[model samples]
Target: MTRHGKNCTAGAVYTYHEKKKDTAASGYGTQNIRLSRDAVKDFDCCCLSLQPCHDPVVTPDGYLYEREAILEYILHQKKEIARQMQAYEKQRGARREEQKELQRAAAQDHVRGFLEKEAAIVSRPLNPFTPKAASAGNGPGAVTRDSLSNATPCAVLRPSGAVVTLECVEKLIRKDMVDPVTGEKLTDRDIIVLQRGGTGFAGSGVKLQAEKSRPVMQA
Candidate 1:
């Protein structure tokens, strides 16, 4: 046999060996299995009703409940608060009305008291204008200055067609020469001065002196 030939006779015989099934199983040990999204079930509500929740609301304590149920609870509490406020306002309004009624009654009482006092004053019998006593210094018919001061000075023209006294003439002059009682006219030259021992007759003399001193104006 040639050593360089294609099939060398000096080479050792070779045999093909197949892999064992137990060694292939031992190569891959126990694997860590992970579950998919389809395998896990959805979480449910933690409420006492145990009903299914569509829109979930998470509390601060990390507890989940139905949104509509919790909102209804909050609304009920708010309604209670509103009712309390309305009752309080009604009580306050009633108190204000009572105070106003009391004030009105007090005002009416004050007006009644004022009217009673005024009626008492009007019912008095004393005449304030009547003189108490006549003094000897003043004549029998003569009125004192104190008595005449508050009296309304009046003038009466006698039917004799003569102006009587200076005091009467002055009173007539103040009334535009028309007699206060008889409505008759009197002249300054016709006046007679009456001696009453008082300066009451001085007005007519002063008036005459003033007229004499005034320059006559020609028109």
Candidate 2:
């Protein structure tokens, strides 16, 4: 007996419909749609509403959008951006404080090390007549060096939220550190040095991409 039926022989060709096609069930898993010539493609739809626009507007980057829908989208976007910026500034200030602490610790360590070395030198016995003359100063080969960093990377001004580089801060030296935009009075302590990574382009990419990356900032 063959596998098809007990009556069928091994050489017999078995060709019969095992399952009938159902209009509802068979077609459920497949779709082949054809758009009419008059149909509007997705590109012609409003970017914000995803519908054919009555009052269309084109953004600077050439995306089509409905006027009212786009305006509302922009308003919400501006609010979201402002909130994100505030959070960023708060986090940035915290990090700035941490960096300042690190630098202060380094400076204290350097001073402590110098003092330890000075104490060791003074405790050692030395000939009293060996080094009083100006010509007896240590030669250039002594090669004394300091490890503390004196250069400021960048500076952030508070109250007005302005950030300036070290070079600009240097120009303000021997004078008042005033806010360039608001012309508000500033002090030396107001110039907080900044430290951050280069993530501006990456952030922009996340903001501009499709649904996959859109929620990063909003989240």
Candidate 3:
């Protein structure tokens, strides 16, 4: 027997014959025979092709055989599997490479989008109309007492590019349904009060008046 516990030899034979002619009945005789080393190895395979099993596969009953040979012998007895196996392996390799490339491209796109957003935020310009503190001198753009005295109370109209007094806006809204300048529909909701810096336009008096009015306006 081999190390895997398979019988490595042929069975014994028992021969018996009656007395052929004159001798009494002869006792039974036994003959024992053994297989060679190559034959013993071949006996382990289901295919019995007399070759060493390169890609060995074990059966449920603990028998070993070459994988392809046994598959062809049992399943596709007459067909070949070489071309089909090669094609399957090639397709699997191509699919793996395609998936890798797709992942790489997606990563690159994400990184590029993040960089573009950061660049846009970093390069954005500051607002030019933002207010700054004025020096004590009478330079250009400085707020002076003369300018404050000249400043007047006004209300800006929406979509009409018109500036008028708050009292005129209140009277127009009360009398007409549309703006006299642009002919657009007028409502108390469209009025925006304007205030001059360092002037009395945004003082407690205007706040008191606004608090007393309907749809209260802010300066």
Model 3: per-residue Cα lDDT over 1-219, one tens digit each: 565554433435332322232133343444334777755655545445657777888879888778887877867644447668788999999999999999999999999999999888855432222122336432122111121122444555664645555556555544775655668886665666666444445553444233345685799
Taking all chains together, the TM-score of candidate 3 against the true structure is 0.24
Best by TM-score: 2
Q: Model 3 misses residue 189 by how many Å? A: 2.7
RMSD of each: 35.8, 29.9, 23.7
| Order of quality (TM-score) | 2, 1, 3
Tens digits of per-residue lDDT for model 1, 75-98? 998999999999999999999999
lDDT of 2: 0.59
Candidate models: Cα lDDT each: 0.53, 0.59, 0.57
Model 2 steric clash pairs: none
Off by over 4 Å in 1: 1-69, 122-219
Best-performing candidate as measured by lDDT = 2
lDDT of 2 at 192: 62
